[model samples]
Target: MSSPTPPPPREVLPWSRFGEAARELARTVADSGWMPDLVIAVARGGLVPAGAVAYALDVKAMGTMNVEFYTGVDQTLGEPLVLPPLLDTSALAGARVLVVDDVADSGRTLELVMQRLRAGERPPAQARSAVLYTKPRSVIEPDYTWHRTERWISFPWSALPPVTATATDGA
Candidate 1:
């Protein structure tokens, strides 16, 4: 015999809270006293928090590495795929990097991006990771994290419910 399936847990973040969370992550990085010369934001989720972190940390060099992992809610590809245009090594050489992402679920995405960043002859001097949330199942632990939980998170930027049909729903 088997037990019935349980519903997935959920955590919702409002925009205001999201900002605070990002600042909180920035503070964590700042406390480390290891300022990065550049910020590499994982595409999509990382974009917003990475921008906030860069602004807060006063880091002028900000770039993004697009990696497609999540296909839908609680769904993801078999493996994280690196999407181009890949970050140019011309800018990364000798730069210290702070990798930012919204969440580290399985941590595979972070792992993949790190591998890419560290590749090539002139890799960055140092690279650290920061994320708003870290899941218990994450394979890699981040250097800086605002929260650690196992619940599924609904980020403010990606949590819009489907628009209810109105008189002019699709108009």
Candidate 2:
């Protein structure tokens, strides 16, 4: 048997549109009028977008939960996995939360967070997911999205290629 064929690379270039894109995404959430009491970011990628949305909604409360999905360019685990130390949900008791991620590639990671927030002993008042971009293949649709694209994203924070191992290790 042969290894499954890897997907073709889909590079997205967003040179100067980072802030604009983030603000646009935030607007979508505000327009929806869900009005979260707190903003919870899926760390790494969601950090910026979540902050922007929190500000747009005038939601001062914010938190972050880290999860790992992508391992390398065009590579990912069969399922998105939660990474700890998870965000402290104690403050989220009875608070409506807007969960933010950069993109929803398969939607599993978003689903995990949503379930976690909703199932805890002191579950939140409500929880919703949002993203800057959404792929058609996502298993779960987000409550708010600014754009839809199938291409692998080129977020401003992660646009540059990683430095070679040799350079980092001084080999």
What TM-score should be assigned to candidate 1? 0.89
- Cα distance off (Å), candidate 1, residue 96: 0.8
What tens-digit string does per-residue lDDT give for candidate 1 at 86-163? 888667888889999999999999988888788856788898999999999999899999999888898988888656
- Find the number of clashing residue pairs for candidate 2: 0
Best-fitting candidate, measured by lDDT? 1
For model 1, the superposed segments whose C-alpha errors exceed 4 Å read: 1-7, 161-171
> Where does model 2 exceed 4 Å of error?
1-15, 163-171
Tens digits of per-residue lDDT for model 2, 79-157: 7778888777777888888999999988888888898888887889889999988989988899998889988888877
- Model 1 worst lDDT run, 10 consecutive residues: 162-171
Estimate the lDDT of model 1. 0.90
Error of 2 at 14 (Å): 2.4
